[model samples]
Every structure is written in structure tokens, then in C-alpha cells.
Target: METAQYDITWTTPMCIMTLRYIGLVMDVYDGQKPKDKVKPEMMKTAIPNPPGFLEIAAYGYFFAGTFVGPQFSLSRFRSFVNGEYLENGEVRQSSIMVSIRRFVAGVVYCVFNQWGAVWIPDSFFNSQEFFNLPFVWKIIWNTLWFRATMYRYAMAWCITVCLFLINILWLILACF
Candidate 1:
């Protein structure tokens, strides 16, 4: 059981690191792309040293957005680590109100989905009554299915937003 848990813990981050490594290789290896074929954005401004293995490991296991991520490119990650993410010396303040609003919205969606789910019989779709139902009723049931499942997506968005909000708060507090 411990082995299984250990495997699960390492495997996910390993996959994430693998993908990030692939992106770095595709960008940095000149042999992978002919000079003429490279896009303007792909051209390195100034040749920077490739990140070391330890740095890559740190970035991969940074714990924020590792599971459900809006993944950043290698270049963006590098910029962030080097403290060059904002060039203009402007810090964007994250609104706690906005975060709270999203959290509230997510909670409402979850509650509504749970409440509505009680009316939806688990075996209803396979039951004869479902087949015997009129076309209008079928359409309504389909709509209900759509509504009931929407909380999952909403919660996912809420979680990501909350993560960003926390990061922003940390940044603000740290700088002061």
C-alpha cells in the first residue's frame, strides 16, 4: 500500500516534468528546427543558459497548479523565477472581493446541483418510464443533466482562481 501511494505521488509530477522538459527541448535545440523555419517569437533574444535539472525539478514540484493547471510555458516560468515577470514595475493587485465572489458562486452552483440531483433518479434513464416519456419531457431531462453536471466545471474554475488569489496575496505581503 505504501508503494502504491509512493508511485501515485511521484508519477504525476514526473509526467508534468516530462512535458515541461519536452517544451524546453523543442524550443532550445537548434537541430530540431532549421533557421528559416523558426518563428520570430521562437528566436531567443539573448541566449540564456538552459535551466539545470534541480531548477527544473523545483519548478515542476512548485505545488501551485500542479494538479489542475493553467500550464505556463518554459520561458514564462524562467521569467517568473528570474524576477522579470513585470518589466514596467507595476504590480497588479488581486482583488479579494473577486475571489470571494467566485467562491460564493461556486458554492451556489454546488448546492443547486446537489439539490436538483435528488429529484433525478439514478436509474431513471434506463427505466421504461424514461423511454415512454414524450419528446418535450426528454428534452427537459437532457437539460437537467446538463445543469446538474455543470458544478464540476464551475468548481474547477473556482479552485484555480482561488489558487491565483492566494499567490497574489502572498506576493503582495512578501513585497511589503
Candidate 2:
């Protein structure tokens, strides 16, 4: 059987959004139950009142997490929107350094991924030359190739996290 590869653009966001919506629905359900019936940790996330359409839309398309995510609950999103993190009406400025570090790490990972891909292209895996390699050499080559592939995901997530941090900073600044 021949394996076919399809260029899927929507599936990633669709899958992420599906999970987010499911979690949101479950949280809303938990909110409808009496406080005593819900788990303590879950109670922290339960929404006693349903969010408006605009709130749901904002959370669903939240730019920082739209592509790759560190999924957060609707309650957390509300708290963020409500400025719950502010102390003395001041936004914490410490995250600027953290964002810078994450951005630098993401750039480094991207560079490594590009460099590695050029030296160890995935096409080499299916080449006849690959089949001629000794077992030990093949194992080593496969490990290197896998690491190269994984670097792409690492780079993406790191950059996504940096974007999240920057978004928070922007929101805080806008409020001041």
C-alpha cells in the first residue's frame, strides 16, 4: 500500500480548538453543579456564569495559543482580562526578561533545525544509500534525524510561549 501525504493546514487549529471547546463545556457543566459536588481543583476553573459570545470568541482565537498551546481554562482567561494579576494597579514588569530569553531560545532552536535539516535531509531516510549503511550506523543516523525533526516542534512552542508573554505585556501596558 502506498502512503499518501496531505498538506493539512486546518487540522492543527481545529484539533486544538476542539479540545478547548470541550474543556470549556465541561467547566461550564461543573459550574452548574453545587460547589460541594465539584472537585476542589476543578472548582477553581468552573464558570458559575456562561461567557458571552465575544468572550468565547476571544478565548477560542487567542493569538498566542491559536497555533500551539499551553491550554488554559476560561476562568484563567477571565482573570487575565479582569486584571487579577495586577498588584497596586501595577503590571509586573519581570516578564519582559523571560520573554526575551524565550525568544532567544526559540531563535537558537530554529537555527539548529535549519542547519541540521541541510545536513540530514529526511529524504536520505528513504534513499538506497541509507539501506547500505551498517546497523550501528543506521541507528545513529536515525537518532540524529529524529532529533532534527523534534527541533521544529521545540522552536515553534518556544516562540509561541514568547508571543504569549509579549501579549500579556502589551495588554498590561494598554491598561495603564
Candidate 3:
């Protein structure tokens, strides 16, 4: 169980890096080919080059959205590195508030999920002792376990989205 948790932790970042590398390959392939020779189908799946290896590595390891992500495209990463994203920087008040609200809601959701998990112990369901419980109690236990697992996932996703938005907001401010 410990090893499984450890492995799960690295899965997201590795998947993100794998996608980035695949994008890099397609981008390099497209860049090397003559524009006119490229087929329409090929263009649909192609991505442009990221700024450089350093930029690619940075985005892949970015703490904000690495573990649990709302993954951005390679082109967006490039534009961010080159400061082009901020060129038309319109920092709307409502957008800022919305992002802030998302971040707050994420924190609340994470806390609630943690609380729910602790309140309903998984060991109880897996242990031999659970079989002795009343039928209704068993059903309740199963339902709670399912809900707890879902909450864990929802919390992670919400946190990722919150962090991603915060990063974007910071980037806008930093560039200006």
C-alpha cells in the first residue's frame, strides 16, 4: 500500500512530461518539413516548438499544476516563456475575483475531503470485523468509502485548477 501511494504520486508528473516530449517530437517533425509538403491531417495534430529545452523542462516540472493538472499546450507554454501572453494583458477584475474564488473553494474542498476520509476509516471495511456489522451498516460503509474516494479525486482536481489559475494570474502580474 505504501509503495502504491508512492508510485501514484509520480504518475501525474511523468504523464505530463511524456505528453510534452511527444509534442516536442511532432513539433520538431513539422518544423523540419516544408510547409507546402505538409498534409492537412498532419497539421491537425502538430504543435509548435516550445521556447527551448529549459522552458520545456520548467513547464514539465512546474509545481503549480504538475502533480494534478489542467495541462496547457506546448504553444501556450512557449507564449508564456516569451512573454507574448502578457502582451495583450487585460487583467479583468471579475476574472481575478473568479480565480481567487476558485483557489479558496479548492482549499475548502481539500479540507472537507480530508475530514471525510478520516471520519470514515477504510480499514473498517476491509477488516474481518466489518462482516459482523448489520446489513444496513455494511451498505452504509460501502457507500461512504465510495464517496470518500471520489472526494479525494475531486479535491485533487480542484486544487490543480486553482493553482493553475493562480499561476496564470501571477504570470500576468509579473510580466506587467
- List the candidates' TM-scores in order: 0.64, 0.76, 0.62
**Top candidate by lDDT:** 2
lDDT of 3: 0.67
Which tens-of-lDDT digit does each residue in 1-176 have in candidate 3? Answer: 34522234656677867776676677668756877878886665455442576876786777654676556656666666676765367444335666677767767776776776687766667787898899999998888767766766676776666676777777667776
Which is the better candidate, 1 or 2, if ranked by TM-score? 2
Clashes of each: 0, 0, 0
Clashes of 1: 0
The lDDT, on a scale of 0 to 1, for candidate 2 is 0.85
Q: Residues 1-176, candidate 2: write the lDDT tens digits.
A: 33352222557777888889999999999999999999999999999999999999999998776787768899998887788877876668658889999999999988988888899987898999999999999999999977977887788888888988988888767877
lDDT of 1 by residue, 1-176 (tens): 34421233445656766776666676656425666877677765222456678977766665554654556666677677666866586666655777788778778777776776577744677789999999999899978976776765576567567666777778788888
Which of candidates 1 and 3 reaches a greater TM-score? 1
Clashing pairs in 3: none
Which lDDT values do the candidates have, in the order given? 0.66, 0.85, 0.67
lDDT at 163, model 1: 65
